[model samples]
Target: MKLTESNALARVAAYCSKAERCEYDVRKKLLGWELTEEEQQRIIERLRKEKFLDERRFVQSFVKDKIRFNKWGKAKISFELRKKKIPADIINECLGELDESELDESLRKILETKNKSIKAQNDYERKTKLIRFALSRGFSMDQVLKTLTGIIGNTDEEYF
Candidate 1:
């Protein structure tokens, strides 16, 4: 079925209204509809004007969702936003909204749960595995080590 510009615009508007949408998402959807560049731009402009497509809003919602529901770390969230073609300033602004203490607490909670599930050979091995796991999860290596140190208790040997 062929969609006229008006029809496409309406469809895209409806799509954006359903949830927070970045310009990248809307552009991809319009492109899939076989809209020309001009048509796509028109629809995108209208969506932006109508408050349907907002990068800031999208970034905020994305960060909140990934952190609260997915338990993703700042690095992962930033990477995903970049993949969405969000501007660096907006990404930084949204990331700034996340409180450091809150993030650390969240990481601590996740680490505690992960630690319970893993059975390592010794304190060193456990700390090593935990650090690796947190790093894989996109957490800062330094922060993870610090939290691990607090949770696992300090030993004579250094674990980095």
Candidate 2:
């Protein structure tokens, strides 16, 4: 397909209409289409002017979806957002809006479900596996430990 300014604008407008998109996402797509830097900038400005692009709205949707659907922790979601070139202030603000209790509950549920499936010879091994799993899921180590302790009961031996 031949890429032209008009076609690029049309295609990009359609893209943003379908889902929330950050400027980085749109810029990357334009880059892939080999649009000139000036063209990319113009289209971006047009999108913003038309209310088709809003960074705050995009961040809000991204954060909510990642937390509710993907069960992602702040660390993981923030990392992904950063990769997409979302500003730190926006990322921090959006993440801050999330309820801590809800996050902890989500983490707890994830760990509980994972604990059932893990096959370990001893409590130490089981706890170790659970911790690693939660951490890998973007949850903080402290959050994982606290949640794990609740599910598996407190032990005299520290399993870090």
Candidate 3:
């Protein structure tokens, strides 16, 4: 199947109109349209020239919505963008845009989710459970310990 330049531009225009998309995603779509490698590059370059292929914009939007709606951690979100063939430097730039407080809150929300599922009644057991959960959710031990200690240890009543 051959892809004409006009067809490719129209299709990309329609796609970008629906939502912000990264160049990698748009390139994949172009390939699906059976565009040749040169054709794909041409379309991508055109899109970039038109400001529809902004990488930083894609990164910020992706970071914002994933954290806000998907409740994803920096680790998970970084892993995902890396899978998309995004550059490591850009991924760091994107992750860096999130404030430390925002990261902690996202971690807190993850801890809450994990804690709610465990059957442990003792504070010790509960803390252990949270450590495992947050760690599995890709939080660092340091952050996990800090958040669990801060959120769960605010009370004096013995849970055991």
Clashing pairs in 3: none
**TM-score of decoy 1:** 0.94
Give candidate 2's whole-model lDDT: 0.90
lDDT of 3 by residue, 4-70 (tens): 8889888897898688888889887888888788888888888889888888888899999887787
Candidate 1 residue lDDT tens string, 1-160? 4578999998988898889999988888887888889998988888888899889999999988887878788998999899989999999988988888877888899999999999998888888888888887779987887788788877334554
Model 2: per-residue Cα lDDT over 3-98, one tens digit each:
999999999999999999999999989988889999999999999999999999999999888878888898999999999999999999989998
Ranking by TM-score: 2, 1, 3
Clashing pairs in 2: none
Q: How well does each candidate superpose onto the true structure, as a TM-score? A: 0.94, 0.94, 0.85
Estimate the TM-score for candidate 3.
0.85
Name the regions of candidate 2 deviating beyond 4 angstroms: 155-157
Give model 2's clash tally.
0
